[model samples]
Target: MLTSILLRLVGWLGGGVFDTLIGRVADHLRQKASDDLVRFQTGVQADTQIALAQLNAQIEARKLQAQIMEADRGWWVTSFIRPLIVYPCVLHFSAIVLDSTFMFGWGIAKLPPPYDGYEQAIILSFFIARPFEKVARVFAAGRT
Candidate 1:
């Protein structure tokens, strides 16, 4: 009878100990998973912030390019160049849009691929990069 009681006591204590060890392992794993999730979220947020900063920098650069052009030039011939190129392109685009929308079938000749590429380069440079040409007098006058 004594042996039987001792065996029962040992089995009970061992079962309790086993249950405690399993619970501790489960808790540790849960905590580690939570920490990993938090780390991943933080990393993603940092990446997003970096991307946004780069985009903002590009926008500011374009704005500065336009501003610089506005400040750097004057006089009729110098000023006339921008509108000279821009107006015709604008009109051409409008005509294309109208023809396509109304199905006018005017068959307005679209700018061929090479010419279109050249046009894009010209427009982008005028609006988004430094002015292509500057007067000799402006440079001689020592003005930036």
Candidate 2:
């Protein structure tokens, strides 16, 4: 009878200990799952914010491109119109002056030919003006 009672008591204590351990394990697992869920939510929020920033950047870039296109159109119109109005008038004026000077004989012949510095000045002016003319040609090409 004594042996039977001792065995029964040992069995009950062992069962209680096992139940307590199982409860602790379940609690630990629940805590870990809660932490994982929080981390996942935080990551999702961060990703959403990043996506929104990227979308905003794309919108701004498109706006800038539209502005640049408008400016380019304005430049194109001015480039064509200015040369159209200015070049022929300037050519006509230069031709008239040359013709009048040649007819009257009161042109470069009236000025004393520089015996010393004139030749150098003419050469230098020609070189400087040539590059300017090439630059003007480049601008004209852009218009067409």
* Model 1 spans > 4 angstroms off: 1-14, 72-77, 81-144
Question: Which residue ranges in model 2 land beyond 4 Å of their true spot?
Answer: 1-13, 75-144
Q: Write the per-residue lDDT of candidate 2 for residues 8-98, one digit (tens) a residue.
A: 7875888888667768999999999999999999999999999999999788766665664465447776858645644544454455578
User: What Cα-based lDDT does every candidate model obtain?
Assistant: 0.75, 0.65
Q: What is the lDDT of residue 130 in candidate 2?
A: 48
Candidate 1 has a TM-score of 0.43
TM-scores of the models, in the order given: 0.43, 0.43
Best by lDDT: 1
What clash pairs does model 2 have?
A: none
Backbone collision tally, model 2: 0
